[model samples]
Target: MPLHLADLVARSELHLSVVAAPDRLDRPVEAAHASELLRPGQWLQGGELLMTIGLLLPMTEEACRAYVQDCAAAGAGALVLGLGRELPYQEAPAPLIAAAEAAGLPLLTVPDEVPFIAVTKAVFAAKAAEQHRALERVFDAQRRLTAAAASGRGLTATLEAWVDATGIAAAVTDLLGRPIAAAGLDDLDPFGPAGLPPAVTELVHKVAGRGLRGSASSASGSLGSVEVQPLGANRLRGLLVLVGTLAPNDRMPASGLVSLLSLELERRHLADEPERRRRSALLGRLLTEGVSAEHAHDVLAVAGLASDTVRTVAVDPSGTSAEMAAEVAADLALAVPGGLVRVHDGLVEAVVGDNLDLIEILSRFASGAPAGIGPAVPPEAATGSLRQARALVAVSRALGHPAQTREAHSARLLLEFGDRRALRGYADAVLGPLDSADPTGDLVRTLATWLDTGGSWDETSRRLAVHRHTARNRIDKAMRLTGRNLDDGDDRFDLWLATRIRQEMKAPGT
Candidate 1:
């Protein structure tokens, strides 16, 4: 269905004849150009017909062979040697013929009466005619596609009509990379349990992460060449993917399809705004103020995040607007079913079920943003999860990456999630009188050091760089104020643990 060297040679008006590589005359010709330089191949692109008048031509047998090799190497579809009155050669040279035949490069001879301009005109005319016909077909296909879209039959019918018109398989995916609609041209169905091809799926997320700045890109994979086009007007709504073989002209219909499909997705997104707002409100309520376990479960169930246990994932909205962070959360929402995402206070957070793999979800959608995943907790205890997430989020930001609560490996885990009132009461009851009386931390340090050294006065004094008498005096004064005895195992252990807890919580997370 493409113009080939054989077609040009077979034309009666041009008076052209194949001089070499007769069997290889079927090479496709994409364009035509003329040059008289020795190595004319320098100007040629692949599938071009190069015409020369033998000026400054290589005349030797070896030189001719190299010339033909150069032409073939440059991906010239055919070589046309003009034989006319003013040209160096009156006919095809034997060396040139031998070289062309050896290299399997189709060589054509133009009759003296036929000028090189006629050959160039013929080549481009055929190309223009082909393009014109393609445009005509595209116009017809656009009308059919528009009708299908206007029929209100949804994306499938519009895609089906486009496929029937252009013979290209296409699919649409949400920002989460979930397949929304797919239309295959023939027996190849893009929609299956296996889902979209890995390359297409990757591009979907890549474009989704870029939001409004995203553009179109293509990749080759198991499905051959696939092109991904981002869909939306003011914001990203989804991705439109075209898979399989595509002609240059095929972009015409694909663009039209993108416009039609983007409108539909935008409409759907607008329609879902109220529900999204409600879910966001519920998440805010669940995070800031405590929600009843039953009401939390109801909210989670209504939001589609149904799990007896769930973890809270929070991303600090640093160097980005709340709107931008919220968009990122919305993009991540489709990474899993029942993934509830919202912007509460200043952080972009999500309540995801523990049953799903959080790591993989984050890997696929989180990109470069720092995320902190809190420990799995019940719906009623989500407030604590948010607390832990806030604590770890700073660590993640400082580390310039994401982290999980399980990765903390410190006392902050228990200290953050435990009852704040009870822990505060315990610390105050244990350290209150001593801290008030001493004002400085010497007494607490002496008691902790003495306990750490197994009640060794000398070791405590040595560690503190003080005399044994001074350490003994401090310990006695601490005992007098706190009413605790170091010789008792219970008192010693409680004192040590309380001091460590206080030290760990001294610097809090923002």
Candidate 2:
């Protein structure tokens, strides 16, 4: 506890008296200063007890009021008057008393027998003792926290010890403001809002972005106090958030706690890196050929995954650069329990057991970014499942849907089996005569447009920027050259398949 005016006056040796409105004696005295200048407040700082005589003060009420007002404005914690020799008055002046009451400053009176040095010595002794006690408390808390961390359950134990010491709730969050660890809160979300509160999350971003340490509080008292400290060096790693009241001295210990927590988190990260790499390689092997089912089952059992059946998800972060999307996917995959994630050929793939909530886990990583999820399949069929997911991703992007699962897009499986050479040969066989007959290629273009427009001649003509009759003639010429009857369902299917095959061949990697 700090030294207050009441604590000073209660000492029997000092023989101090409370002269004017003494209701405010609870104000803490951070320091003690003695000055006889006309305006002693000039040399004073807030939370200080200013002791003086009436030597430089005027007898008039107005002069005394101005003097008291200045002390109050200067944030003087209390005014102590020595009234035996310097000033002939037996008590504090009436105007000074009234002004102190109005300004809510405590006023104390000391006898001439008590030397000024005695009061200063008392304040010094009290402050030193308080400092010693504070240090003791901080050191003890640090020891307990260190013990908790070394006891094998480091993260959770450290957090629980911090709560016991500070009586405050704390949470550790990633750069995305998602909580990775928490204590003293009912839910895993210790921030009190769904996900992270946007205001504090924005602050976390700024701190991580600029390598800054920040503290903010709610004046409305709704959130008490909030402090954010960055983790890691050079680059931002994570953040620590504390929500509660803390004394000025408590802040130092809080910072020390943050440093300890960061070390533990980084230690775990370094320790887990090798395992993460091993799981990634295993997933890669499973997706490729040559890994036997028995060998794969052994690996899956070692990694705590189902050996027989697994589900894989392919995330397509449309419009984002491949590098950034891959990084996010990798992080999410590693975070998921018993899951393996890999990024290849512009897609993020995760292989997990059948019991996981695939949608919820993907949503956490996707965060509104579009993705595609393949159906559950046997371990040997993982490659085919991923291909189906990739095709669905393409279909979803083309149709302007956010995401598509295997059940919603089973037809996309047809796209998985076509050989590039065979597809190209078939396309040429179906459309080769039409291409040779029309030097301008109008017949092929008209046929494509007519098919895309659902065989509506009017819509096809409007899309081609030509008259309806001209479009009709082009279609008739295409049918005659191909020797395919337009009214036959089989011929129409063949024409559509050829156009699709040609389109796929023109794609970048094909």
Candidate 3:
């Protein structure tokens, strides 16, 4: 229990007496401080018991009232006015007492014979004891949680320990809020037929969607106050939902519990990593190379992906790695329902039952990098889809955003399967003159725009935000570089094809 203003007055040895707003004596006193400054509120935090000698107090009644109001506004637990020697009167001034009463500020009087040191000592002693007890609780909770985890009880055991320590119904859930472990709230099925109850569902969204690490609650009956806490660092691994409102003192333990649960969950993922790799390898082979429908069906079954029609998504690698690709694919599979992801040919590939928003999911984990997607296709046609997705990857990089195969307009299919070395050599041969003079890519942008607009200078200028004369000048320079006549349809078509091939290979126009 916190010390209150009445507790100090009740101490007969202290020689303190209440003079104003005695009814509000129950307010908790966080600490007792002595100040002689006119406006001590500048240094005073709330919930403090402010003790002062009358030497620095204003002589005017109105000034005294303002002084009292300042302390109250600063959230002082109560004001203790010394009433002898330096005091103008034997007791608190009439205006000061009246102001305190109006503001519901508790005011106490200390006789000059009693020193302020006694009050300060008592407050410090109580605060120290409270802190010691809080530390004890935290240590005890940590030991129990560690013991339960070591007992091979898994996440469920740790959650049970949290319930025992905090006396609240607690649960661990996946990103989608499906309960993986629970205690004290058997009736609250986070994955029930109707899914998590409305109250719990709303709180889960707030925590996961907003990336809130602190507790969030819903004020609903039966469900009561539900607190949702996130459970990972860097990226959210899962959620921790407590059914009842936690005590103010239990907040620290709740955070520690989240840390412990995150470690245990990560350990579990590590233990299963071997099997995940095997699954990723199989899926990778199936997507990059042509596989018979029957053979693909068998591989998908073994990988736990039972989808007949799956959408292929391609993520351009940040760096090359088969292991990194496998890890990312496995993580995506766990995050999404009924999905298989793998790394094939230095790219991350995901196949999902539905065309789930891989962009949104990747944003949660790996943002800033664009992804390419192929339209949904039959399982046997995965290689064809991967080919299309590969093409979209180039398109995506060229457009500086995510792209889908269905939206592709260039000769992407031929570009994706062609020999890379041969294509780069051809591009350099065709656009070398332009690259020599225009290394800033201004000419390349102009050429791309002119080709896209079907040689319309007006539309090209509008698209590029340039004047008509500027667009024509750029086109003239590009034509001179390539030594092609813009008026000749054959020359224009050849340059357009070369530009398309260059974009697909991610090579500069040169």
Error of 3 at 101 (Å): 3.7
lDDT of each: 0.80, 0.74, 0.77
lDDT of 3 at 405: 71
lDDT of 1: 0.80
- TM-scores, each model vs. reference: 0.63, 0.63, 0.62
Q: Give candidate 3 misplaced runs (Cα > 4 Å).
A: 35-43, 52-67, 81-103, 111-113, 163-255, 281-303, 362-372, 390-392, 401-403, 409-510
* 1-510 per-residue lDDT for model 2 (tens digits): 778888988998988888776888888888888987778777887988888877778867788778888888899988888878655667778877887787777888888888778888888889899899988888888888888878888677888888888787777887666778878765434356575576667666556555434544442235556767776543345678777777776676687777778788667666876776788788887777756777767767777776578777777766778766655565565456778877777777778887866666565456555566677788777777777777667655554443446435322334444455776788899999987888787887889889878999899989999999999998898888899987999999889777766665666875
lDDT of 1 by residue, 349-382 (tens): 8888888777666655665677898988999899
Pairs of residues at least 3 apart in sequence or in different chains that clash in candidate 3: none
Q: Is candidate 1 or candidate 3 better by lDDT?
A: 1
Model 3, span 150-197: residue lDDT tens: 888799999898888878888788776677888887676453665577
Question: How accurate locally is residue 420 in candidate 2, as Cα lDDT from 0 to 100?
Answer: 58
Error in Å for residue 246 of model 2? 3.8
